[model samples]
Target: MSALIYCPFPDREAARAAANTLLDRKLIACANLLGEVESIYSWNGERGDSFEIGALFKTSAALLDDAIQCLAEMHPYDTPAIMGWRCVSVSEATAAWLGELDRGG
Candidate 1:
């Protein structure tokens, strides 16, 4: 199965940096930046809103955990919102590509 990781970065530069790191490490096959988005949430007993750059990472299920862990460690926010999950249904060709990507295929 394939996996998807959704994370919001502080800015475009940060998002690009993180995406490149993930690619260089072979943690993700590709990443898509969704531009700026307004995020509203409560943190540390306070509620606030801010604009963030959204990113989607494509990878295999085998690398999802490692990818998320690495991203969390490198993220700028004290508690960045990183969401990941295995895809319930993915085309055979795409799944194969994602798996092969992690193996440097």
Candidate 2:
């Protein structure tokens, strides 16, 4: 199985750093960065709003746990938003690509 992970960073540099680290470690096959996203949420019984950089990572389910651990260690925030979900459907080519990535190809 393959998975897609989403994480929000305080800035683009941080997001890129995490993405590059994951990629270098072969924990993620690909990463897409979304810059300057306005995020609104509640924290500690308070409403908060800020701009952040969002990143989406693609990898095999077998690597998800390790990838998450790496992200947690590399993340700047005390509680970074690191989320992932199994991919229920994917093209044959994409699946094959992910498989190759898992094999370090």
Candidate 3:
């Protein structure tokens, strides 16, 4: 199975650093960095808005747990946004690549 993980970073540098770390460690296949996303949400019982960099990572479902943990450890947010969604469908090549990664082959 494949999964897409979403993680938000405080800034572009932070996002780049995290992406480099994960990529170096082979925890994720690729990370797509979307710069300066406007995030509006409620926190501490109050509405807040901020500009954050968003990174979408593609990896295997089996690696989701480790990937989330890695992001949590490396992220600057007191409560970082690291969420996972199932990649129930994907292109054939992408699916095959995820499978290979999961098997570490």
Candidate 4:
């Protein structure tokens, strides 16, 4: 199954750099860098906020865990938010395209 992964970065350059790394490693097939994200949260017993950039990654379930690990390692923030969910359905063409890279075979 295919998956869509979400991760936020400090800037577009950071997002693009990470995306390129993941693509080179075959951990993700594609990434969509969504602009300026306003985030609010509580951490270390304090309310926190951030103006970040977000990216959506496309990969397969088989590679999701690996992708998360890689993203964490390269993420600028200590506590990066990396999330993903399996795609229940996709267009035939999308499936076909994603399938080509999903298996890493």
* TM per candidate: 0.93, 0.94, 0.90, 0.93
Q: State the TM-score for model 3.
A: 0.90
In angstroms, how far off is 43's CA in candidate 1?
1.5
- In model 2, the runs with Cα more than 4 Å from the true position are none
Model 4 agreement with the true structure over 1-105: per-residue lDDT tens digits? 789999999999999999999999988889999899999989989998889998999988778899999999999889898998999898888877778776673
Q: Single out the weakest 10-residue window by summed lDDT for candidate 1.
A: 96-105
Tens-digit lDDT track of model 3 for 18-60:
8888777777888999777999999889999988898898888
What does candidate 2's lDDT look like per residue over 1-105, in tens digits?
889999999998998899999989999889999667889999999999999998999998888889999999989998999998899788998898887767986
Q: Poorest 10 consecutive residues of model 2 by lDDT?
A: 96-105
- Separately for all candidates shown, the number of backbone clashes (residues 3 or more apart, or on different chains) is 0, 0, 0, 0
TM-score of 2: 0.94
Candidate achieving the largest lDDT = 1
**Order of the predicted models by lDDT, top scorer first:** 1, 2, 4, 3
lDDT of each residue in 14-55, candidate 1, tens digit only:
999999999888999999999999999888899999999999
Better of 3 and 4 by TM-score: 4
C-alpha RMSD of each candidate structure in angstroms:
1.1, 1.0, 1.3, 1.2
Q: How far is 63's C-alpha from truth in model 4 (Å)?
A: 1.0
